[model samples]
Target: MRRALHKWGAAVVVAAGLASGGLVPNAIARTPENPSRVPPVALVTLPPEAQATHKLILAGGPFPYSKDGTVFGNRERLLPLNPRGYYREYTVKTPGLRHRGARRIVCGGTPPTKPDTCYYTSDHYASFQRIAP
Candidate 1:
C-alpha cells in the first residue's frame, strides 16, 4: 500500500501544483485564459533596492531613469493579461551597474501612482512574481 501511494503520489503532486498555479518542473503548462499565476513575493522580503523602488512608485517618483515610469508592454506575457497601457514599469536600482539592470517593478492600474497590483521581475521581464501588499 505504501508503494502504491508513492507511485500515485507523483501524479497527485503535479496535479496539485497545476491547481494551485504553481510550476511543475520541466512541464509546460499555460493557457490564454489562465496565464501563469506567478507566486507572490512579500513586500518585506524584497531586496532593499526593490523596496526603495516600491516606495518611489507609491510616492510618485522623480525616478532616476528616464524610462522608469513608462508603459511596460508585457510582451513576454508572463504577467496577467491586461489591455494596452494598463501596466507601467519602473526601474529597481542595481548596485554596480552603470546602466539600468534587469530588476524592475511593474504596476498595473490607472493614475500610475495608485496601482491595483504590482509585480517584480529580476530577469528583464522573462518572469514576474506578484508583489504582495
Candidate 2:
C-alpha cells in the first residue's frame, strides 16, 4: 500500500511539472472545474500573489513581517527533500490581513542572497508548487 501511494504521488508531481510551464494559465482559477486536468496542489502554477512573493524574495526584501527569511525546517517532507536549513521560508503577504497568512515562499540554496529554486505554498506546508524566476 505504501508503494502504491508513492507511485500515485510521483504521478501527481509529474503532472504538476508538466503543467508548470503553461498547462495552466494566469487566469486559471483553482477550482475543481476539471479534476483530472487540474494540476497537483503542490504545482498548481504560480498565482499573482505568489508571483509577487517570488519577486520580493529575489529582491532581498525589507519584508513586511519579521519571520520572513527564517530557516524552514521541512518537517512535513513535502518539498524536494532537502536537509534542514537548506530551505528558508518567506511570508507572502495576503492583502488585508493583519498577520502573516498561510501563503509562503520556501527557497532552497545558499547565502539567501541567491537560491537555486523556490516553491510556493498557499496552504502553508501542506503542499508546495515550484516557481522559477
Candidate 3:
C-alpha cells in the first residue's frame, strides 16, 4: 500500500506538470510577445444540424457586446431574469485621460424573450449609450 501510494503521488505531479505546458518540445516554444489566448480551432466541421443549433444559441439573447459589461451570479446558481444576467460594469482608460472610468458590457447567456441591453457610461453611470443589436 505504501509503495502504491508513493507511485500515485509521483504520477499526479508528472501529470500536472505536463498539463501546464512544461512537456512541450523546445522547437515549438511560444514567444513572449505573442502569447496564446485560445485553443486551436477544430478542422472537422459540425454537422449542419449541430451548426445551426450552435448559431441559434450564439445568436441568442444576452450576447456579449462590450468588454465593460457587468456579470453577476455564482457559477453554481444563475438566474436569467435577474439583472445580474444582463450586463457588467468595468473601467477603461481613454486618450488624454489620467485615470479610468466606469463602463458597462453585455453578458452572453440564453436568449431572453425580450433582449436585455446595457449602455456605456461616460460620467460614471450618470448616463449611458443604449447599445442596440
Candidate 4:
C-alpha cells in the first residue's frame, strides 16, 4: 500500500511540472495589425520647350548623365520631388532604326513608347516636364 501511494504521488508531481512548463498546445502569441494610410496623386503640365528638353535629357547627350542614364543633378532630391505618391522609376529598351541599332535607357515613371503619347496631372508632381524622346 505504501509503495503504491509513493508511486501515485510521484506521478502527480511530474504531471503538475509538465503542465506549468507549457506542455499544453493552446497558448497563443500576440501580433500587431497594419496601419491604414493612402498617399495622394499629383497633377502637372509641361510646356513644349520643357518637354523637348526632358526628352533630350533622357537620351544620352549634353545633359548631365548619371550611370543610370537619369538626368538629375541629385537623384535623391528628384525621387521625393512629388509629395503626393511614391515616385516609380522605369527603364525602356528599343531597337534603333536601320543602322541605329539597339538603345537601352532609364526614365522617370513610365513613358509611352509612341510619339503621340502624352501625360497630364492635376496636382504638382513636384516638377513636371515633357519627355520628347
Candidate 5:
C-alpha cells in the first residue's frame, strides 16, 4: 500500500539520520540522568582557563567570581539529575572579558573539592561534555 511505503520510508530516513548523526543533535541526545549520550573530553584537552578553574574548584577557591561556588540548578536538565545543592558552578575566564563569560565548569557532589563528576560547557549551558578524570 502507498501508506505503508510512506511509513517505511520515514522510518528509513530517521534510521539513516540517527546513524549519520544528522537528526539527533547533542541537545536532543543528552537527556536527564542519561549522560551516556553526552560526549567526553580529557582534562588536558580543556582550555587553560578551564584547567585553572578546575584547580580552584578542587582547592575550594579563592574563586575570582563570587558566584563560582554557588549551586547550579541544572534546570536545562542536560546533566544527570541530583538533589538541590548537589552541583556547583565555576567560571572560566575568557580572554579580555571584563565580566564572567559563557565558558564554565560545573561539578556535582559533596565537599566542593572532590566532585564525583565534572562537566565543561563552552556555550554556557547549551551543551555539556563530561570531563574524564
Candidate 6:
C-alpha cells in the first residue's frame, strides 16, 4: 500500500506539471495567440545594438541615422506578404561604423510607431527574422 501510494503521488506531480502550461521541461513552447503570419523574437537573445534599436522604436526615437525612419516598401517579399508601404525601416547602429550597417528593423502598419509586425534583417534583406508580432 505504501509503495503504491508513493508511485501515485509521483504520477500526480508529473501530470500537474504538464497541465500547468508549458512551464515545464520538454513541454511544447507557447505560440502567439493571434494568427501571426510571422514568428516572434525574444528580446533577450538579440544583440545589444538590436536591443537598443528596439528601445528606440518603442520610445519614438530621434534616431541617429538620417534614414532612420523611412518607408521599407517590402519589395523583396521576404516579409509575410504585406502590401506596398506597409513596412518602415530603422537602422541598427553597428560599432565603429561610419554609415548604416546591413542590419535593419522593418515594421508594418500606418504611423510606423504602431506596426502590426516587425522583422529583423542582418543580411541586408537577403533574409528576415521576425522580431515582433
Winning model by TM-score: 1
Cα lDDT tens digits, model 3, 54-96, are 3333354233234322454322111123445553443434446
What ranking emerges by lDDT with the best candidate at the front? 1, 5, 6, 2, 3, 4
- Candidate 3 is scored at a TM of 0.29
TM-score of each: 0.78, 0.63, 0.29, 0.21, 0.76, 0.66
Across residues 40-122, which tens digit of lDDT does each residue of candidate 6 receive? 78766777898888778877897888798888866444465556677788998788988898999887887677767678878
Clashes of each: 0, 1, 9, 4, 0, 0
Ranking of all candidate structures by their TM-score, best first? 1, 5, 6, 2, 3, 4
lDDT (Cα, tens digit) per residue for candidate 4, span 2-33: 11112212111112224455443432211112
- Where model 6 places Cα greater than 4 Å from the true spot, the runs are 1-39
lDDT of each: 0.79, 0.65, 0.32, 0.28, 0.79, 0.66
- Cα lDDT tens digits for candidate 1, 1-133: 1111123121111223455556556643444455566889999999999999999999998899999889988766667778999999999989999999899999999888899999999999867889997
CA deviation > 4 Å runs, candidate 1: 1-28
- Write the number of the candidate with greater lDDT, choosing between 3 and 6: 6
lDDT of candidate 1 at residue 126, scale 0 to 100: 64
Once fitted onto the true fold, the runs of candidate 2 whose alpha carbons sit more than 4 angstroms away are: 1-45
Q: Which pairs of residues clash in candidate 2, taking residues 3 or more apart in a chain or in different chains? A: 42-129
Error of 1 at 24 (Å): 6.8
Say which prediction, candidate 1 or candidate 5, comes out ahead on TM-score: 1
How many steric clashes does model 1 contain? 0
lDDT of 4: 0.28
Q: Model 2 misses residue 120 by how many Å?
A: 0.5
Candidate 1 lDDT for residue 44: 94
